[model samples]
Target: MDRYIPPVGRWKLARRTQQMTHSALRELLKVAERPDMISFAGGLPSPDALPLARVAEVTQRILHAEAIGALQYGPSEGYMPLREAIAERFTRNGSPVRASQVLITTGSQQALDLVARVLIDQGSRVLVETPTYLGAVQAFSQYEPSFEQLASDADGLIPELLSPAQLHDVRLLYTQPNFQNPTGRRLPLDRRRQLAQLALETGLLVLEDDPYGDLVYEGGPLPPIHSMAPDAVVYLGSFSKILAPGLRVGYLVAPEALMIKLVQAKQASDLHTAGLTQRIAHQLFTEGFLEPHLHALRARYREQCKVMLTSLGLHMPLGVTWTRPEGGMFLWVTLPPQLNALDLFDAAMQAGVAFVPGAAFYAVEPRHNTLRLSFTTSTPEQIRRGIETLGRLVTARLSGLS
Candidate 1:
């Protein structure tokens, strides 16, 4: 046994591998699975929302009629029919996207990786919201770009705060304008316009990630920044939210010049998205299953959001505040400055309630007195119970401070 030990250190991993860290949300997902735990940790869609029967039908039909295509190696740019379907949907949503401009990737996460690889150099200045999506930070970090946090508030990132000085040397600005993760803040219409204008003026390439755009609960869809500045923005879309995450199908639209490079990067990465999944996703789009499914998802999630809001209002101690998002799976909770969310995690876990601490969402300086609550997966009763438990812990902390 002793002789069997290999020279592990001699293997010599890449520098980027050293920089890669496990996602905090993914780590917390283990706690979320405990039978006794009421988890608001992962941004997971409800099991009820998954169109299982429909998916089965689509999969069977594709295998029967197009088995060869489904099983064979697909184009790196993706199945042309699926790409065209996504492009048409984007065009209907106010952004005029073309199939030629779309490049299908394994997932939106891969799209993020490709964008980072193409645009970022070592020490390139990349701008992000004050507390941005942790996944974006993780993806972009591997490229060794310098991250700069933009000023933000409850409404979301402020276009007004992006001064000329801040714009200097900024290679990319990543934003999730609609129903953003962690905070669940939708950038307002005016802010979207201003941001689009700023990107155009500064020649900044904006990566607009809009996986949750179709989850609107309270209002009509606002024009995407990509629509406002098509040339300056790269848009990422996914079926993971509206369809199913397991399919791992997502697409990105960029300027033709940029699309060429992205397609090359994708080819090197995975060749193409899974062929069977691409065929299944295309049917889900063209066979008329997506629209009604979105309606049902909106209604269900809207109700879940309401219940969580009510629970927070009823149970949270004074000085604890949370965002009331119009649409999205998650919301941000800011605890009293004296109480750190990270410090509260173990106790909350012990009490069978789980939520992600907010500091993980930040790209630069993190605010310790905050956390994120995902409302889409848990039931109304579970939400109330978990929030009550969390509230009690927070009260005890506040009492200790007093």
Candidate 2:
């Protein structure tokens, strides 16, 4: 008999599928899993920080008392109690939000996907920081928007640099103002106000993705840009960073008018975030377990950040530079101009250290002379060893040694 052919060869993929490529960071995560490797690549919370006991108790209580509803299909908007709880928290934080305005998602990543689906069209202008979150870029790219790189400095996005032309025909400004991913740069309060005012003046919508807002290790968190102009900014929050990421629970708060569309998009995406996980998150938030847990988490991450900073200071070459992040898991590193981070990856891998290169974080005009290191997952000793290994590689490269 003739060889049988599979129909997969004849199937045509959607144009959006072409934009979906494997995440460079995720690929590094595989290498990170090897026991001998010291990885600063993945943006992971410390395993020690997970509230295993509390989560176990809560999950057991729910399953014992409300098993049927918890396991059943849920409303597309989300579990109502959790939505109310989240609304109350945001309102207390200075952003007055209504429960009706909240839409729970599979994860904050799903929230990003939903926002892109509802807002972006082919050729839409999307403003993003120079080295923005790669995950957001990945989510937004599928919709085929034209990304405009906003100018940023060491501290993060410069709101003053936003010109009138940049706002013209812009669909949304996606930002992680609080301890932004890859760079670990937080926007100052003054800039937050400026950004809010700019959005209001230009009638631009801002997507404030604040997964790391609660991870503050120094000083305090500035009021969110969403709080400054509640109607103009769509805010996304997550339990992943502070709590466990395995649950895949997150939410977005939008003005009620726009929220309806987001809810519809979410329904089309996934009926709702899992009721069980939503309930678990809500119970943790309302029962007063989350705050103390966060306190412990902040202290743990603070020490990790300190260790990484101290190690980098002691070992890195004279021309090498890195951000001193007050909070958050990752920090950006700029190698000497002569050294390219991508070129050093293989050697670093062989040397048993792994980090995400800065080029993967960019939407356009990637800088090969940079990389990102996450401090949360590794121990202080591992961080010191990893940085020492990386610094040696960088030094050798600058000296024209392989």
Candidate 3:
């Protein structure tokens, strides 16, 4: 019997850009959901760190007092009060920015997307750190920019390495600048100034995504690059790490010229982020709840970082290099060149631990020998167990390679 199949017409599909799909770090979190798997893959703030009680209280107040405003659609630029609060936060951090400069986004992820949409044309040249935030790359990739990876080290992006030739046609330079994701490297004060100077000299635009700055475990916070070269840098900040990620609240600070364009782009994107979420975030900030809350986050993450560091010292093989981050959710580990981290991932997963292969974080020519291990989500005991398992896997692989 012949089976009747539907006739296939020419497939109407997405553009070349849309055809590419990138997986999120959260997808690898499936391992943690299994109860048996200990995850070192999630770039998450500690669950215990979220100000749930405060959020619940503030949310209840917002719903009861301003039901219509909370539930109804908000201005494309965001609720004014929240923008003011965000602006004040920036000023308090030594970056004197106005509320008009702040464009509330669903998350910093949205800020990155909107910036990409507004600034990037097809095939526009863009500069990124050697191993930067995978999410930023995913967001920017939709615009089809030609990514030029700049070399970096423990201090973050090397300013001297960014040549004038690289700046010629580059539309934007994307950087985390503080407690960078995947690598957990912070750009030092000197380098931060140098970068600002370079941007000023070369006329390059900078997109500064800083979600983890408030969670600094040690050292005084440096002024944002935007503070030095306000016109050249587009600053992205988030309440996710300090307050709660579920709120999905973040903001972008751009020069008036750039923000005007981004506001139109954002309005067309999501109408606006949920009004209730913005209201709740504003209430928390205005009611003076964030400072102590941030303190708690710092303390907890510091202890967790220590746990992971101790575990690594005890378990990791000699000659393996790993970053010792002052603050943030991750540490980047570079294995011996003979060992391919992607090849080792399955063995680590089978042994009940999971981490992100660093190759995925690179925009081009992935470094197969590196991987990112997150320490924020797992417990100390789980960290110890997972690292021990990972260490054994590495030992066996290295031995076989030898």
Candidate 4:
């Protein structure tokens, strides 16, 4: 008898399940968790910056003050007070954002999935930044859209190549214009305007993901593309960076008509984001905890970034170059053509450091010579040690010594 035929063998998974591959970054982050390894792999915000004491206070206050409201099931559109608070944030920033246009999500990731579910048919054309957010790529892939790479430079996405002809039949353009992950590049004012102009001209929709916008170290906020072309954009924001990520609250701003469909999509997914967390977030924002907490976080990341940058400059061999990020937790590094980041992973982990290879960020034409380093998780001393270890390893590889 053939070994008992498992019932699961007869059960085929969805095509999307077949398409899903393990996240290299997630696996690397786990390797980074070893006690002795100094990891620059994860995009985690600094743990010290989490307002634990305040969270404790707020937890007590919310439960004692509004237990019934916190525990109850909420609307698919999100808790009403949080929706109003988010809308007010947009209004205060010079955009006319109405509460009616907002939809709260489990996280901004859910927003991405909802957009893909409601808007994308299989094989629909979608424009994405070259080396875009890995999570966005994963979320959007469920619908199996044909992805087109938008060229990017130091200033971020290049709108010139994305002319009207290129955009015909394009379902949506996904981008992270501020402190973009994996690369830590931000769009300048001119590029932002050009992107908005191109989208408006072609009547294309833009999914603007901005989880790291507030992580800008020292500068005024860059006006979101949605602000410039409100009707043509869906904007996503998250509290994971400023506040604790464990809360799992994020939202999307889109036109009301579009939002109705997205809310329905969301209803099918999770019914709603957690009511307790949403209400707690609303309370925190109303009490003005975000701005001040963000200032302290920026300062911490700025100093950590400085240490990492300085260490890289001091130790990294020639043929290795890295981004000097103005804000955000990460910087991108490019090694020589001969040194492949994916190939170097084992050596890196063995040498007491771990990082995400840059190949995972690209939708097409992945660069094997590149990698990303996150600066927020380590102490300045740990950063120095980690960079030095990495530098020594690269030098050895280039010299054929290890």
After superposition, candidate 2 runs with Cα above 4 Å error:
1-8
Tell me the spans in candidate 3 whose CA falls farther than 4 Å from its real position.
1-11, 17-19
For each candidate in turn, the TM-score is 0.97, 0.97, 0.95, 0.96
Q: lDDT-based ranking, best first? A: 2, 1, 4, 3
lDDT of 4 at 325: 75
Candidate 1 lDDT over 285-357, as tens digits, reads 8887788989999999999999999999999988999999999898999998888998899899888888999
lDDT of 4 by residue, 111-228 (tens): 8889999999879998888789999888888788899888888768898777788889999999999888988888888888988998888899999999998888756678999999
Worst 10 residues of 2 by lDDT: 1-10
Task: Please give, for residues 1-402, the per-residue lDDT of candidate 2 as tens digits.
Answer: 633433457785665676788888887788776888898988998988889999999999999999998999999999999999999988897778899999999889999999999999988999999899999999999898999898999878899989878798899999999889999999988899999999899999999999999999998878988889989999999999988999899999998989989988988888888999999998998998989998999999999999999999998989889998888898999987777898898899999999988999899999999999999999999999999999888888877853
Q: CA lDDT of 253 in candidate 2?
A: 90
Model 1: how large is the Cα RMSD against the reference?
Answer: 3.5
C-alpha lDDT values of all predictions: 0.91, 0.91, 0.87, 0.88
| Model 1 clashing residue pairs (backbone) | none
In candidate 3 the C-alpha lDDT for residue 319 amounts to 72
After TM-score superposition, what is the CA distance of residue 252 in candidate 3 from its true location, in Å? 0.2
